[model samples]
Every structure is written in C-alpha cells, then in structure tokens.
Target: MGNKPLALTALSVALGLIAGCAANSSTTSKAAPADSGEKAAATAKISPNKPKNDYNITVNYELGMHCTGFDFTYCCVLPPYNSVQSQVIKTATGPKKYPELLEADEEDHSVVVDDDAGKRFKLSYGFVDNTYSEGSKLAYWNVPYDVDGDGKYEKNENVANAYWTHLYVYEGLKGANPKGTSKDSEKLFVGLQIPVPLDNGPAGAAVPSPMKGGHLHYSGEKGTIVYTKSPVLDNVPIVLTNPGIWDALGLPLTPFDDSLVRTNPLTLTEDLVRPFQETFVSLVDADSGKPVIDSHSGKPITFVGTSPIDVPNCSRCHSNETANGKKYTLYKQERA
Candidate 1:
C-alpha cells in the first residue's frame, strides 16, 4: 500500500527502453536521461509468442476502455481518524461540542460541504502509493484513500481518494537486459482505487448519517486518461478504470455507443465479447480472420462499434503477438 517509491524505478526503466532502442539483437539502445518522465515508461517485454524483427515495428496501442469482468465491493466504515481535525467554528451561541468537533476546530481543517444538502462535513485523509498491472503496461498509481470514510477525502487534510487518480507511466522491453529485466520485473503497477471530490476542494462534507450510499461510487463520465508511446507497451491490455479515463479520449458517450446493453461501458459483459470479435479475429491471420458471425446463426457478427481492423492489435501478429495481456495502467490523462 505504501509503494509510491517503486513507481519511480519502473518509470525510469520504461523511459530507457522507449528513448533508447527496441529489443534489437545487434545493439542495446542508449539509456534515457537522469531526469525525464518519458524514461519512466519504456520498460516492457515482447509477448511470449512475439517474433523478433529489425527496425521499428508499426503497431497501434489502441488505448480504449474495456471492463475487467471482475467487480467487487467493500465497506469503508467511519474511523475516529485524527487526521481530519480542523479549525473550530465560532457560532453565535458559542463554540461547538463533541471531542471530534473540538479536534477539527483545533486543527482548523477546512470543512467539506455536501453537494446534495449543502451541509458541513468533517473527514479524514491518508496517502498510500500502490502498484498494479494493466495488460502489459507496468504502472504506479498514487492511491490515497479516505481511511476514515467519515466524508474525509482531501490532500490538505493530508488525505487522498479511496483509490488512485495519479498514475505513473512505465515502459517495458524484451530480452534479458538487466535494465530491461529488472525494470520489467519490477514494472507491474497493480490495482488502484481512488474516490474523491470534484476538484482540489472537498465536495461531499458531513454527509447525512445513517445514509444509503453505494459502496463503489464512480461519477460517470468523470473518468479520463492520457496516452504515450513506449516499449513496455507492446502487449498491454485496454481497460477503462482511470478516474478520468473515459472522458480524456474525447470519445462520444451518446446513447448510440451504449444502446446494445452489452456495448455499454456502464453494463459491460463478457457474453458480449462478440462486440470485439472483428478486432479480435483480425488479430488472427488475414486467412484466419473470420467475419463476426452469429453464435445462434452462421451470419456475420453485426452490432454497434463494429469496424475494420487496423494497427496496434492487427500489426502485432507479424511483429509481436496478439494484444492479449493485462489492462494498461493510468498515465497522466487529466490535469491536476
């Protein structure tokens, strides 16, 4: 949970491979500079099935949003979190009561105002640096959670989201190069969960007690993500988990995109893997590539979001392998 330091290491290696060289057999690419964010993203490996090639390979890192088909929930009960302590409020009658209130007042902590009822809310915050994987991309996500889900989510309180929005990019390369080997091995930045206010300021303060709130809260369309080129990026998977991942693409979120229920990012399902069939099948061979046919009938696979294949997934077969790996982690896709 306190793994933010590792992200720098991974980012260092990723950037090296990217700016240096592909995993060519003749000579290794020169390493990146001591201070560069791009150096952090260059650490990746060729898929096990990838075939070696000379010169740069033309592939598309189709940074799209897809579901993990795995969703679970846990409760974040309120804590006597001492961190949320804030400045005392001077009412017309007198100062406030309660040990918790006194603690907040003494600390001069800014109160979070509730969006629904416009009520004053107190909260607690804490920071945890997390590492996780997305496809082949090894990423570090700075996950700060409101340990005391007592409506306390902030950085000024020295706290962060229940998950992570800040992501560190890493690049991966192939072969046993220590720079590549160690970097790639240490590259994985795993699952990061971040929940937060609308902006730098707190949004949900002093929420109603005995209130009914969803366990995993996500403000739809609030998620966005950014992308860049990298060597560690070869077989990275595409998932839509970044807090701002969906919005950053500038993709349309109309009813037209999600009408099929299965195609809906809101209601993604594996049963509808058919929606990605053409793209998937195209990764097979031109001869092996089959049209999206119906499971019930032998007709072509037809549905929304269907289109011809292109780079990224398609170019890899001859160059590397199929783009079938874990999801890509968050890069800096949104502004602070």
Candidate 2:
C-alpha cells in the first residue's frame, strides 16, 4: 500500500531565535500577549510556528495503494484535471455524480466545470459524502492553489495573505506531562505539510504512532496543528447545490454503499478517511534549509484530535451496495 502521515514534527533549532526572546524553562507559558507581534514571538517558544525547514511532508491516498494516489482499488487515480461527469449520474443520487471533474473530457466525465480542481496538486484524498474513505488522489476540485503568480504551485506562506485552518482535538493531562526538552505539537500539522524543511529536527519530528489502533493525537492529544493548506487551506464553504463537494464527501454517486458508516467520536474514524498518515506527500522548495514552522509568513496554528463520525446511510440508488459496488468496490471508509 502507501505510506501514511504521522504527527511527530519538530524543528532542529530552538525557538529562542523565532520567539524573539529567551527559552525560560522556569517561566510557565502564560496567555499570549494581546499584541499579534508578541503573540507570534511567544508562539515559537512553547507552541509551534510557521515552518522554516521541511519535515518531509508526504501524503498518499487510496486505501492500501500499492503505490500512490489510488490503485486498482477505489477508483484509478482519477485522471489528472478530469472532472467527474454529471449526466451519466441518471441512476445516482446524493452527492457526486459518478465522477464529476474526473475525466479529462468534460463530455466524457459529464461535468459542466472546467479543469478538475485537484489536477495540479494531486491531493491524497477528498472529504465529501461519496468517497470519504476512497483515499486515492484527493479530488481538490475546488481547492484553489495558484498562489505565487509565478505560474507554479503555491503553499500558504507563498501568498501575500493566506488564511490558516486551525484544528482542535481535546486531551486533558496526557499532553501536560513533558519529560524532555522536545517541542510541542503545535507545529505537527505544519511539519506534516512541510516535512522537507523540518526533517532535521529533534526526533525527526516523527509521527509517534503509525497504526490503525487509536487516533493520531486523540482526546489526550491536545491542541496541535495537524493539517494546513495555502491561501484558504481547506475551509471551503459547503454548498449543497454543488455536487462536487458532495462527491468529495463520499456521495456514492452510483449505486454505492448503503451500510451504516462507522462514525464514532474519534477524529480519524469520525468520517470516512483514506488513512492520511499512510499517504506520501511531496514538498515544494526543499534543500534550502527552509523551516517547517516559520513565523516570518505563517501564524501560530492549532490542531486537535477527535473521533470519527458514524457513516451516513445514503446511497446513489438508495440501496445497500458497498463502495464501488457492482463496479469495483473499495475497502476504504463508506461515507453516504
């Protein structure tokens, strides 16, 4: 299959430089100063900051993909720039119509949109109602990434004003006990995104757990950035009229799964997941020694862990047919 992502990101150098202050072990971290500048500085101390180095950010979708994106499983790594068709969805219902913005040919894919949004970046997975667990290449049909204006890919920091997406998963004392001089988990998500820059950090900013047993940073995992994107990241508003996002949420456009989606209180399992930790993501500008948690451009972000939501019982044909159904069927999470 593919390699999953973990949350053990850290920086090689101490935060004293970025903190704009000293590392005072005796001084307990207090509420950040009201001033944004002061807050940014303190964020570097105990909390995670924008990355200056790469943590070898990597993500691969497609459950048990022998390689990257998707494989014979789920749906063949949706052709790059191809939008899922809509007309062929006569028999389908709910979100996603077969594969909107999926095929290169708009007529073939049967979509009214232009190039597929996930074409350039080649995401690891989508989070709509259909293919929630179809972790192949994230179908970022609407995720805007053209940031630098250099006619190239753009990371959040690359933009003049990039919005940060903060994730929070609560954990009580489990995260309070720190025995070593290691860094906090705030930058974990940033590191996960920018692995290349932060790879040289302590403990290699490793992902503590790489299993399917528990949450990555479950209830005891506290506030730590787990994932982030450039510009607006993944804070796209959901428009029910728009079926693209519906498809992204595992809509089961065709006669898809009708079983009760397992949505517990766990973050990973809360919804259909393609095993983000197992994906292989690529870094942008690495080898230049750029840090993963850089305050120069990014702000202090937060990410918390939670439980997976129970899978919804809504299929295309409105019947119980597993994922991919009579077509292929995937072992990933079945959302709707």
Cα lDDT, all candidates = 0.23, 0.23
The candidate that wins on TM-score is: 2
Clashes of each: 61, 96
Lowest-sum lDDT 10-residue window in model 2: 83-92
* TM-score for predicted model 1 compared with the true structure: 0.16
Measured over all alpha carbons after superposition, the RMSD of each candidate to the real structure, in angstroms, is 28.1, 26.7
Residue 226 miss distance in model 1 (angstroms): 11
Cα TM-score per model: 0.16, 0.18
Q: Name the regions of candidate 1 deviating beyond 4 angstroms.
A: 1-61, 64-161, 165-257, 262-269, 274-336
